[model samples]
Structure formats: C-alpha cells, structure tokens
Target: MRELSFHGVTVRFGAGRSALAAVDGVDLTVPAGSVVGLVGESGSGKSTLAKAAVGLVPTTDGEIRLDGAPLRARRDRRRLQMVFQDPYASLDPRMTIGASIAEAVPGRPGRTGRAAEVARLLELVDLDPSRAGSLPSGLSGGQRQRVALARALAAEPDVVLADEITSALDVSVQGSVLNLVRDLRRQLGLTMLFISHNLAVVRYVSDVIAVMYLGRIVEAGPAAEVLTSPRHPYTRTLLDAAPRFGVALDDPVPADSELLDDEPPSPHDPPPGCRFHRRCPIGPLTVPERTVCVEKDPQPAAADRPHRAACHFASDAAPASLEVPAR
Candidate 1:
C-alpha cells in the first residue's frame, strides 16, 4: 500500500541562505505496513519533513501525497496523526485526558460513552482508564507520552508520523512505549514515519532508514544494512555522535552541536553546486561523488541496492568514522 510519497520535495525559507537546496531533489515513498525512519540532527530538516508529511507544515516546493492523494487535497487531517515530542504541550492543561482524546474522534458529542472509549484507548497504550480523569499535569512524563499515543490513536489512523515521540520519556519507559507502538503497528498494520535523531532508537524500531542532511536524504536502505555498514559521510558522523548522544552537548568539549559546515547556510539562500560542499568531510572524492558533491549536487542512487546515498564517492567510500563494536 502506498501510504505516502514525496516527489522532488524541497523546502526553502526563501532565496538567499542555502539550507535545503541541499535537498533540492528528493523522492520519498512510504510503503504500507512498514516503518520508515527519518534520521538527522536538529536542523537537518528531518522534523520539517515530518511536519510536512502530516500537513503540520507546508512544503515550499514539490508535492506530498498520502495514499496517492495530494496531502494538500483537503485531507480529513485526523486520518494521518502526529505524535509530538512534548507530550504535555500536545495535551491541554485544563482539559481532562479523556476529553482530549475524544476531540480527535469524529462526530462525537459530549462525553457520552467516552469513559469506555477512553478506557479502551488507554489500554491500547498500556495506560489505565482511571487515569483518564487526570490532567496532563497530573501524569508522569512517560504516562503523559503514553496519553499522547492514545490520543493519536483516538483518530483511528492508518498511518502515524511520530516526531521524537519518546525523547521526553524516561529511559525505563522508552522500551515499553516503543513496544506498544510496534505491537500496534503489527496488529493494526499501521504505516508509520518514525522521525528521530537517535540512531539506536531508529534502528530498534524501523524496518528501513533514511538519513537526512541539510534538507536531503544522504543515505537510505534497510535498517540492518545502513546501521551495520553506513555509506555516507554524514551517516558516519551521526553514528559517531550516537555513542555519546546522551551526553549534554553543551558540556561536551568541542560540542557535537558545532555546525558541520557554517551557519548551515540559509534554507532560503543556498550556495552554488553541492549544498554540502562547505561541510563535506571527505576533501575531494571520486568523479560523480566529489565533482558534483561540493560544486554540484548528488543523486540518491549511488549505491548498488537498498543502500542509496547522495555522495558521489559514497559507493566506494569506506566506513572510516563510525565502527560498531563486535558483540
């Protein structure tokens, strides 16, 4: 089932700083009943892609289609739900958890039979119905996030776009929430676009992976292949950062937060040639990879199969940076 597809999607704030021109030409397809993980740093455009997928943000260029229908084509909105990182903010401080969920359901008047529906939704997310009466302020971080999940499901959606959904939950509860989502996806066969900066988290839940940089996908492939033998330079760096991701970046000596290049360029006004030329670590690689990489742009089909990368040298480039330990 073609749940979602983006053809040559590009997002530019305007024409000046080159932020997303790096991703000028991108094609994304989310097959039905599969989890596609979109991974990148804070400004890598991962979240922007997520927001666009669910119609939370508009795309500056290109087209986004859901179930082969244009996403902008008056979607029911509830059909494709989003689970935000801040669970508390997604919920209302004044409204009860039960009412919050009921609002997502169509044509539901008042709280009639809402108690049972709330209970069922809570159970769906491994929460207790008794807690439905409680406000988001009364719930723990994990519980609040769980409530967020339940609320997303309240819409009875066939597809879910989870943007850093578990970032705020306790490590202990992270597994359970991920498990719940996995279980639901398996049982309900829901299609999901799981956006996250955590490589491990993305690896744990995704069937396939799409690594983003600037505003384009640098590498994409089966999760196992991409994680085990990453190809792109950005992919390796991100993996290297993963081992120490838990460390407060501010406290880290050099700080992983350092811009790979400079200013990340402006999404509005990008540079000439490869948008990543300024930051691409591999000095100058092979023909297609390097020639266009820094001065031009790269197509995402450099790899042999599922492991497609945008770098010109990505095909022959060895994994020099991130090497997982032998377990």
Candidate 2:
C-alpha cells in the first residue's frame, strides 16, 4: 500500500471572472493501509476532489503525491483505481462480468489464464465464480456493486477511490457492502479514500474522517473524535441531520437547530468570509463572539483537542452544543 497526499490542491472550471472553484485548497492525507472518509452534502466538492486524486479532473494548483513522490503527468494505471457511485452505470452492458474484470486486470494473460484470474477476483469480493457468465443486468444491485469492486481490484491498486459506492443500496445490502470493503482493506492492506454524504456509513468504515463544506475541509481527525466531539458547527449539523433508526420520521426536529434546514451557499459565487455564515445558527446573528465568522475567512487551525476546524468559534463551543434534542 502507498500513502496518498493532497497538498493545496485546487480545481476550477470556466475562464477568468467567470471561473468557479469546484475544489479549493484541499490538503489531506491517507496513510498507507488505512481508510480516510471524506463526507459532505451534495456539491460540497468532495467528488471533485476525488476526481482530482485519480487524475479524472485537472487541478489548477498544487500537487497530489503517492508515497511522497509527486504524481507525474503519466502514471501507472494499476497503481490507483476509482470505483464510481452507480454500479449499473459503471458496468458494461454488453459484456459479461468475467469479461469486464479480465479487461481491467494488469498484464497480459491467455484466454484460459484470464478466466481463472477473473474467478479469483470475484471470490475476493464475496461473489460466486459462476456469476462470471452473468451480465450486469442479471445481478442484484449489491452483486453488481461487488463486481464493480472486483474489477477495480483486478488492477491490484495501491489506493482505491470509492465515491458513494453504497449510497444506492438497501439498508441491509449497504451493511454487507461496507463489510466487504472493510474486509478487503484488511486482507489486501489497501489504502482508500471513501467519499459519501452518509455520515453514518463513513463513521462505520473510516479510521479518520474529513468534513467538507463549500469546497473546503472544515474538520478532520480520528473518526470517533470528529463524529462525537466535532469542533466545527457544520460537522455537528451533519451529524444532527443523519436519521436515527428508531426515531420516527414525524418526530419533531429541534426548532432552533441549524441542521437539515438551510441549503448550502451557491458555489458559483461563494460568500466572503465564512461560506457557512449565512446559514450558521451560531454566527454573529446568534452569538456574540461569532462576529468574526462574517468578517474574515477562517483557515483550518488546531482546536483544543486533536482535530482541526475552520471555524473561529470552535474553541469556544463545547462538543455537546450539537447534541440531538430529545424528541
């Protein structure tokens, strides 16, 4: 496995004056043989950052490195692989699962040898080797997803970029897929960047987690620490919005909370200072010391604890400030 690092990476689209920064100044690292979860709502630029890591999207500034070496213009295709969100969309409709997996395998193999390799790949993902003859449409969502995963692993990649791979699955199936990924990481010692909007899913599979908002990472640290004692208000809000299994859908939400309510500011023209200030429940409009949230942009700074947060008031607020209100 290899360490993956992003140093001040930025991705922008369109021309000068009309340019929109999709991913802005992201600095993150995934240690060798570990999973780092990146979580955010839609349009938070997490997916764009993932694309930049895999060279699908161009970075306008800074660099991405594997094992401290700067990624080159041309890279080994087998060293990194990306598993996209939609399994159905990612698979080839015309080909059998075996054929697709064999196509992605690294190196030349004769017809008979490649088929054996494909069976092994399928087994690695907990799929039956006999399914190799099945078309993508013939398999269930979970089975098709595992096939997609198997195809990615055929390259024997050092790093896997999994972008919301389980978001579309049923609850029971989601657990199985999550478990498959965890088991694969342990068995293969794989390094991974798992991106998702589902905080609960990320919390289950990640060793460390990064919370993104408006094209920037607002907080990052050990998964337990970041989730339970989140320093950033945005991080807290996300946790609050994640539905509790036993809680009724019609249960009254906290009236004064800043969660699951406001939409994020438009990325096309992000606000000055803190991009979250407009929707921040504890900003200048609500709290006395939070005036700085509207006056200046806060950089990711070390908090009182192990993690880092971009909010100026992070140090002042207690983690329990975000506790879900009793229904």
Q: Per-residue lDDT of 1-327 in model 1, one digit per residue for the tens?
A: 247777888765545543434345567777899999999877788777767667666677898777777766545455788899999999999999988988777666556677778888898888888888899999898889888888888878867889998888888988888898889888778789998888878988899899887677778888888887777767776766665546665443211423353556665555565555565555342223346556655664544533677766666666743222222
How well does model 2 score by local distance difference test? Answer: 0.85
Please, what is the TM-score per model? 0.83, 0.92
Each prediction's RMSD over C-alphas, in Å, is 5.2, 2.7
Worst 10 residues of 1 by lDDT: 252-261
Q: Candidate 2: RMSD over Cα atoms?
A: 2.7
When summed lDDT is taken over every stretch of 10 residues in candidate 2, the lowest stretch is 251-260
Clashing pairs in 2: none
Error of 1 at 202 (Å): 0.6
Candidate 1 lDDT for residue 258:
38
